[model samples]
Target: MTSSLSLTKKLVNVAMGRESADMVIRDGVWVSVQSGEFIPNTDIAIVDGHIAYVGGDASHTIAQDTKIIDAGGKYLVPGLLDGHMHVESGMVTVTEFVRTVAKRGTTGIFIDPHEIANVFGLKGVKLMVDEAAGQPIHVWVQMPSCVPSAPGFETPGAEITPDDVAEAMTWPGIIGLGEVMDFPGVFNAGEKMMAEIAAARDAGKVIGGHYPNLNLGTIFHGYVAAGIEDDHEGTRVEDAIARVRQGMKAMLRYGSGWLDVEGQVDAILKHKLDSRRFILCTDDSHAGTLTQDGHMDRVLRHAIDAGLPPLTALQMMTINTAEHFGLTREMGMIAPGRWADVLLVEDLNDFHPETVIAKGQVIAQKGKITIDLPSVDYPVWARDSVKLGHPLKAEDFALKTEATVGTPSAPLRAQASVTANVIGVIENQAPTKHLKLEVAVEDGEVSLPLAGGKEGGADIAKLALVERHKATGDVTVGLVSGFGFSEKCGIASTVAHDSHHMLVTGTSEEDMAIAANKLAEVGGGQVVVKDGKVIGLVELEIAGLMSTEEASIVAQKATTVLGGFKACGCTLSNPNMQLSLLALVVIPELRISDMGLVDVINFELIPVIETGK
Candidate 1:
């Protein structure tokens, strides 16, 4: 390791109780997350991207070129950190993600690129890592351990075995293994998953956990025994308590539809559980949510409102997350030798980031990005993620039904195959519902009703999994609810959970086909279709999951799409987010995969309709 002299010298001065620093902020209330206390009248001096001095009045000693900033009684807190998230889920590239989160006081993130890993494997992980290395913020990556998410369950575009995890351990900027989404495999002690966890343990790195089920008995015990360190999928208060009691950090998340923070925090407030083992995360936020609302700042505010003390909530989003990822010495504090990732907030309740600095570099101020972020280019292999093996026609989406020719006069009971386990959309949570709906058969085939409120309207809704990666020309069909999109409108996104395939939802097959093709034509992205025409599109060409363009540009485009959804009578909160996650098989109840519909409860493929009806 190169012994950097600048920061070291500054730290030596601070250790001697002197402030020989390049930058100093005097007269601030330091919200010291380290000890969960606020130190009044503190001065934080910075030199070479690390804190040098953090105590009373440092005006006595300053370098000639040292820049001085007056905190002016503002509350200085450690910049927030996200414990578990996917940069691709924001539909913005790493540069854009950093720019967006920095405005919300998020100085660091531990991202799991499992979405891209499912499609492009290790190379995809490297693409995100390289881009992360370029940002001013701390954007640490985790090697995706469970690609295909569940072996023999779904067919991903790519497969990453334990060998892949070992190979990625050598990559620079890789902190640990990604979320072990294959919890069933772990519970069963599958050789491959166990080997991957073993490799991560051997590398002396963190292994992220994602056991979404509530069976916290032998199965959960098996998972904890398997060496997973942290979990962000806890929905219930008991789930949070169990994870923490088992020595795993419980990451309470508040994303687009996952309102898990309130329930989990109640566990701490009521049961008096250990709050230090908890962290905050936004598992999957859209571009619109990032720009219009905030990131971890929103999570902190929500947690505080949920009865968590302000300082305690801050620690969960800062120091606790930092310590969990083994980056305590590098960040998560305003102490000597820690990176000067600080946020100046006017109100602790609102948690608005007035000014933000990452690694001693001013990145955002007053909700504006000040730094010039570089655009990371995508390779050719990543460009052609959208694939359609065949041209989609209305006939292609038609469900064939057996003719009742001989039994026309007899009592006719048509057998319709509605791929069961409709992935239920839970608001603000990662898990889906296990719902089953049956559709009627018409004219010798199972078919959905038209836009004019036909006979089978209640039983029919269109769900399409457009093959955006590799031009396989495939569109897996299923049905969804809770969107309430009541017109000839379709929402398509490259943000399909885990696999990053194109997920399109429409009442009309023609409109769905048009929207899917439009996204594919743009390389990969999200598009809104109404009346068989494209109204809005957000091009995420970087990896079929994020736009390399500026965050503002992506936000603007996403806003238009949201408006289109509203015009199409979509009443769901963040309609596109609800649509994109319909394919995530890892979460419970029901989900559609590239292969077919998945019963997450059984961890198997189940028919959309029961047989012998």
Candidate 2:
């Protein structure tokens, strides 16, 4: 850790001309994120990785030994911060993710490795922390609070208890508790959940929230009173306003799929609310988006185009995020006594960092990384984690329904309708709609949409959750709509949210089995198969949620994965993201898990087939 005391002494000496600075960035236009003002022709003096002077004419603190960078009056802003994100969701390891996004000017990231934690528990989180500790940029970790996300709704590979959270708080690089995914548990004061929150409070750390529920009733009040300081789950302007009004930081997100900045930015533009209480984040980004597009840079451009002033957008990414996390003095500015992480950008609106400096060294410039980032390796246990109990066959995905309730019969007598629950997906948002439909029962089985009949389906298909944590050989099936898929295709992945179980959704039973077995055969990853032919695949070697592959390779495979989803007749912009969230029991209204279909609003598991149909 960098010592503030030692840094202060060195910066004081450098500014007083008692000693030479380590580096001097001369003649730069400083975009002061702290004051929302621009200072032209500013010379920033740095000593021991801390800013010493910020005014012009720093020749007095410079020597031949000091490295000097001429910024040439370009806007030097603080390097960006990804306030809330998951490194595992990028399908890359922590080291790989940092190397990929750092060149695009992301100097700091607050990551929640809950996906890996769901698969490997505390050991997985420790592996991420160890890797993050060696990175060049600030990679703060929020300990995974809920391994199963919502208990009784799904089964995870491992479980995290309040004791686990209390122990992790003492670890280095731990920023706070991860997004409390169990919103219902917190609001209702579930003993274990509240104990975990109490541990973070006792340790004086922040508690990130994942309250995607739109209920502004007593539940929302109870949640806010229980102490959720920052939330990145808002998808509308009203949701953003509610968070800020309740003394919480509203983190308007623009992830790969959840494109929320456009809607929530309206809170500031139309409602004219204080922008200080709002922060911008990419809660999740796949490898392709992180490599091809940008991290916070992509978000900032969208925020600016959404009618936010350029400076206000920067504040959301830098200062607002830092203040909410209580790290203002250490970062979020180009001022003295702060880390010397500054970006020399060509245009504030375009917002690409042409020259990036972190800790007084120019690390990246012109879309290329200059620093040497050594490859970090994980142990053998980190890989080879896909465990399907037995070889899966086409029969596993078959949702059997008998004439008698609670009993399943195959090869049915035709001409019967059964009541079933379907996961209705909401586009450009996280929540799903729980729809109760009267489905056709043919040959004693709940007929899929593909099986043509007079009942005429809801355009929904079969959804299955394969237990991968243990050799459980458990496959729980449900129904879902909104993919608009209309082919004999299926997509499978082990990246299911929070629980990280194997999820497969398809119209054809044959293709669903093919996709699921393919993932198990390759340990774990994502696959799309149409008519027993594999089309798209991306291998995640670490905990079945991340890859140790180079960023370019992973991004290429991710692109292919998205292409495959399109080939399978999916029209959602990011279907893979949708597929991953199918098992996320935290958000409403319905999701499928290893246990069964979950009604997330009620925080309980519901039978796939409604009784007495």
Candidate 3:
């Protein structure tokens, strides 16, 4: 039970040479994020897990028992921080996500578990908060502000009200209300959304913002007036400029699927806006990306390649993020009174950490974790979240039509072409296209093009949203394009964004049924079925969103799922991530949920087929 006063006293003593430090790193080129300069031949000393002294030589504070680390003239930068992210998107639990990213120089993360919050409500957020507290690095939790994201568009397993937000504000590790995604609710003065924002403001917490609407008119101005502090949903340079102009931090994200940094970083690079108001984050990263590539380190490399100076890019992920969260005195830079989190890198251009230290202890070396992370034991109820009323069949995914020309007893089928409203997927982006395509009808149901039709042929496939929460046996079926599935394959996942329902999309209804049933049997996860055979699977038994298995194992299994998509002729990169978002009804212009197809531009339910037009 060390008090803050006592810790400060110890740090002061070590700085004044009255006490010795626990660890010392000598002779390093310090990348000073505070002054945005690189100082040569600097040393940092740590005491009681806090930086006590940082300047020239610290021989006076060093003792024989103090562990010494020779940086060998390496660039000593602050440990990276991801200001906004979702741990469930990695398909692994918090502990596993930490194990994979901590070694890659990410010492702190701000996680909004809205994905799990939609499933288990506040209890799920508490689960993530408790798990976050045991990590060696700093992990802050944000109370999910949007449960279903958009009300009346989708039904979640649980709902989070303003009462939940006020109650969570009193709990430890809750930094702020997680991204107020309901821009309509905010600008429209919706009571529930206003109350949530009021609770966070009364508690003196930061209010996260998510204004995906590209219109920077009166609506955007009203949204900014609701006391939102930051936004990460911006994709255009103008979007970045508008956010910064409204005194909001513009967070440029580079995720596993969404590559938005290159498109938005020019706000600082070309428009010459102040870089301090801009932050870097990964809104969602998959398990395979964390295991194979890197985490914040990858974003750093990408930012640098986008023509940002190394120190400027490092500032965006470090001090800029810390200041945005009101944690400047806590853990952002290599300064006195801050936590001793630092990274030693030999090259700034490539940005690979040779040694990673957090809270005055060496945790990883050369892209591998050396410290033992604590394992979490999830409750039994979380493991049993996938509750289906009954087993699914091919008929469950059928889209029936009433265009029959004869009676039921002697039904005569007409080869009629109907104008169908399809959810079109744009690669590496969150927004989808509302496409109207003509498709052939057969046997009173919508017919799909045969497998291996041709290169660049029709990519329409059946998309179904099966309710798995209370098991109402409701399956809303629709049509989607841009998966490019040219085989008898189906892909099902319980990792549907915002609601966490079951999403099954494929060319074959029989294979779609198989994929959906397989996930229910294994509890929850993503699975691929090709040619009536199970091709790949990753079992996520925790809250139906994250796996208890190690991240490497999950990554390996997820790789096979990606390979399965390639075998099915879907050439989109990170298609599983795209598949998961098919149920996210927040983004424009179209999406699918358990209710029906959503026209996000109008924020209403539209028919699968265009009738009047």
Candidate 4:
């Protein structure tokens, strides 16, 4: 093992032409992200996995054993970095996620494992940290600040406390605290939230922020004053401007479902704010997106299409992201003393890497991985997480109502129509609309065809949250619209956000029960059932949030699940991604949990049926 002092000395020797460098790449246009310049005919020298020299020529550092590669005048750009993301969102493990993205030139990532933390607690986070350590590229973990996302609003399988945050701060590879999603808790002076923030501050680490509220008033100022550093939830120009004005970096994200960069990039292009304070990331990309499209490369291309200069977009994903995490000396630039993480691309607009190098090693060339990635052997407990008390029946998903519609003394007829609150899903965005629609009541129960008939009708479906963490036979039922399901099918997913409960939605009650039970039988995964038969499934054996299968295979299986949504007549883009967030109670306006239906705007529980109306 080479010591850091010895490595520095060797790097100095190679730079001074006293020793042969391990590798040399000659005659490339250097995309200097630090200075935002494009210099021609630049050559780079690497020794001991660190860059030694980058100047006019590196011929003196080359020896008989030095491996030399001709760049052929391609643009030498720094490897891309995703400053904020979640590995679980891809439905793959850390190793598999890296295998898919590293070939696409994503050399570094900052992941928040709060999704698994909700199910397995701190032990689960340790599992991710251990897996991240073995990856070829940089994978940093942020201690999940909110396990349940919002206390009293929902109950999680496991809970993370301030003590857990402080303990994780001492662990290796922990960059900072995860997104402080409890914005209300921060401004309202909640004890647990404050203590968690204090833990990251005491450890001198970065603290991520998540402020979804659009109102940039006193509450927003209060949230910023709580020492939150950066946020990726901003979806507007004003949102980006306000965050940077408050001394927080604004992360513009372009994921499979959320395409927020087009709206937020105007903060720099239109408002003329400094681009250094803006970073690019993919908050929640599914396996289909990673395998089919790309990772950070996709974000970079999208950012450029949003009217940003090629160099400006590249800087946002590379140097800007690195500087935000205080890792400039280690990675994120094509300069001396930094890791040799470089990408050779022919076209800046397309942003496809012709050659990918990390730590002075050629890992990929021409869109294929040159080396093999080792498989991870997850423990038995992690594989077997979904535990339903018993097989669910159709009755469990029944939305029963009281016999009286109005006051008991002045009760209406038994078959009268009543107003019901519905959780509405918006396309390509995180926030859902709280919809109110009138539905007919028969025999003290609200059934399907709540408003209109099946085809091109109300577009309403039954949403059920089955508590799988504990063997508690609790299934909270609610109503949701905007899925536009026109068939008699049900979709079930164990990848519910923040709290990994089993969320099932369908037009048929029996199919909903079948979908839920099928996932429990397979440990955990996303399953689609139609007319009592399983049509598509992707088994996530690890933590019920990710699969150990290769990313391509998982993406193939997940694609079928997306097709299942289309077959069920749902037309939303990335419907499965939207389905997964229906239970995220922290985001407005309405969501479901194991306890009951949540009104997130008010942080209270209201009846699915408006009582005494």
Q: How many pairs of residues collide in each model?
A: 22, 3, 0, 0
Residue pairs whose backbone atoms clash in candidate 2: 411-443, 412-443, 412-444
- Model 4 per-residue lDDT tens digits across residues 1-613: 5699999999999999999999999999999999989999999999988899999999999999999989999999999999999999999999999999999999999999999999999999999999999888899999999987999988898999999999999999999999999889999989999999999999999999999988899999999999999999999999999999999999999999999999988899989999999999999999999998999999888888889999999999999999999999998899999999999999999999999998888989999989877677888889888998999999999999974666778756768788899999999899999999887777778867622343435778999999999989899999999988878888899999979899999988999999999999888989999878888899998888999898899989998898898888888889999999999988888999988989889889988998767
TM-score leaderboard ranking: 4, 3, 2, 1
Candidate 4 residue spans exceeding 4 A from truth: 410-414, 450-456
- For residues 518-546, what per-residue lDDT tens digits would candidate 3 score against the true structure? 99999999999998999999898988889
Q: lDDT tens digits, residues 1-613, model 2?
A: 5576776787888999989998998898889878889989899999878899999789989998999989988898998998899998899998889888988999999999999998889999999999998888899999999888888877898999999999999998999999998888888899988999999999999999988888888999999998999999888888999999999999999989898888888889999999999989999998888888888999999899999999999999999988888898989888888888899987998989998888777889898999987678789888978989888888998998755444455333466777888898887678899998878787778876653324444578899999988888989988998887767788899999988889999888888888888888887999989878988899997888888897889889877888887776677888889989988988889988777878887777788887663
Candidate number of the best TM-score? 4
Q: lDDT for each of the candidates?
A: 0.80, 0.87, 0.92, 0.92
| Candidate RMSDs in order | 2.6, 2.5, 2.1, 1.3
lDDT of 4: 0.92
TM-score of predicted structure 3: 0.98
- Taking all chains together, the TM-score of candidate 4 against the true structure is 0.98
Question: What is residue 546's positional error in candidate 1, in angstroms?
Answer: 1.1
TM-score of 1: 0.94
Displacement of residue 34 (Cα, Å) in model 1 is 1.7
Off by over 4 Å in 3: 403-413, 451-457
Judge candidate 4 at residue 90 and give its lDDT: 93
Q: Itemize residue pairs with steric clashes in candidate 4.
A: none
